[model samples]
Target: MDQPEGLTAVGEEQKVCRLQRSIYGLKQASQSWNTHFDEVIRGYNFIKNDYDPCIYKKISGSSVAYLVLYVDDILLIGNDVKMLADIKAWLSTQFSMKDMGEASYILGTKIYRDRSRRMLGLTQSSYIKKVLKRFKMALKTRSHSHEAWD
Candidate 1:
């Protein structure tokens, strides 16, 4: 690897820097992170999903938990609250992370939940609004009425 611009020494300009560890934004960083994460999570008996490599699931008797990984962010879902808390605590010990409480939004999608109805909904209204604003169409309105074809 070529020496970084500002850190290059006058006499050692031809010397290349060797990386000791994976650095963020590097091409191998994500792969390294995923490999390390997989090993740690698997140690806790979590099974990586066959369909999606980023998803892991742990089942113990009646308690079940699902962990979804998106880059550096993680979204945890489960029926048992206690199990989820345990997983969060374990994750905190394993890596530096902050609990953002319940997930309201992720990846431009909004999450809505109704405990009373036991319903969950996902929407992209925020994304749509951003796109409309980007093209200067935020205030534009279109007629929805339709007339019989001649």
Candidate 2:
């Protein structure tokens, strides 16, 4: 690659610099990041899902954990709390990531969990509301004109 402006040496102007790492926003950045992440996660004994390349799972005896990847966002889910914490710690050492605690929302979907009942629910109500508002159909009251159809 050509030398960037303001970084060209006085006598080494003709010398091209080699990239030591992938730069963000480049065309190959996404692929480069995915490759690196896969290598690191696989080293930790995570197996990539055959059906979905973005999902990985790791199991040890009765403990199991899953890691979901989307672009730069990641969601870690599993039944074992200690395994999850270990994965999070390992990932932090591999990349700069902030722990958002328990996940409540992902991809515009709200997550509801009832640990006592072992129930989990997902809703896209917020996304649906946004779409309705965009199309100017988010009415506060039912219109009398549409009552016949109801």
Candidate 3:
């Protein structure tokens, strides 16, 4: 932590301070947090996905579970309910985790599932609208929206 303004001893003005551990406000803190999370999650026998380091998976017998992380939030999914619950409980013990129940959205995409058909879908319609609105280019009609594609 740098000395607070007006509180630093006269000679200390030229000196910089170093932190022993990363914290939220530091520039490198997010990297440190991700590294720590990876270590802890890997310790639970999960393997980090090669394509996406933020994703981890665990397998036991025929059951497979996935842990998707976006910063501090997590999305836990699996075919076995008991196994998912166990992983959630274990994660709570390792960190200050909160169970957010089932995930409905991720990365501004809506998630849809049909258990009977074993199908899953993701949509970003709402996200697109938000982006359009932010840029003051939101179309007033579906026709206008489609015309932009041409």
Candidate number of the best TM-score? 2
Candidate 3 regions exceeding 4 Å error are 1-24, 142-150
- Mind giving the per-residue lDDT tens digits that candidate 1 earns over 22-84? 453677888988999999999999999999999999998999999999988999999999999
Each model's lDDT comes to 0.93, 0.94, 0.89
Candidates ranked, most accurate by lDDT first: 2, 1, 3
TM-scores, all candidates, are 0.77, 0.78, 0.73
lDDT of 3 by residue, 76-125 (tens): 98889999999999999999877878889888999999989989999999
lDDT by residue for model 2 (1-150), tens: 899999999999999988766452687888988999999999999999999999999999999999999998999999999999999998999999999899999999999999899999999999999999999989999999999998
Candidate 2 residue runs with Cα over 4 Å from true position: 1-24, 142-150
Top candidate by lDDT: 2
Model 1: residues >4 Å from true position, as ranges? 1-25, 137-139, 146-150
Ranking of all candidate structures by their TM-score, best first: 2, 1, 3
Model 3 scores what on Cα lDDT?
Answer: 0.89
Return the lDDT, model 3, position 140: 72
Clashing pairs in 3: none
The whole-model C-alpha lDDT of candidate 1 against the native structure comes to 0.93
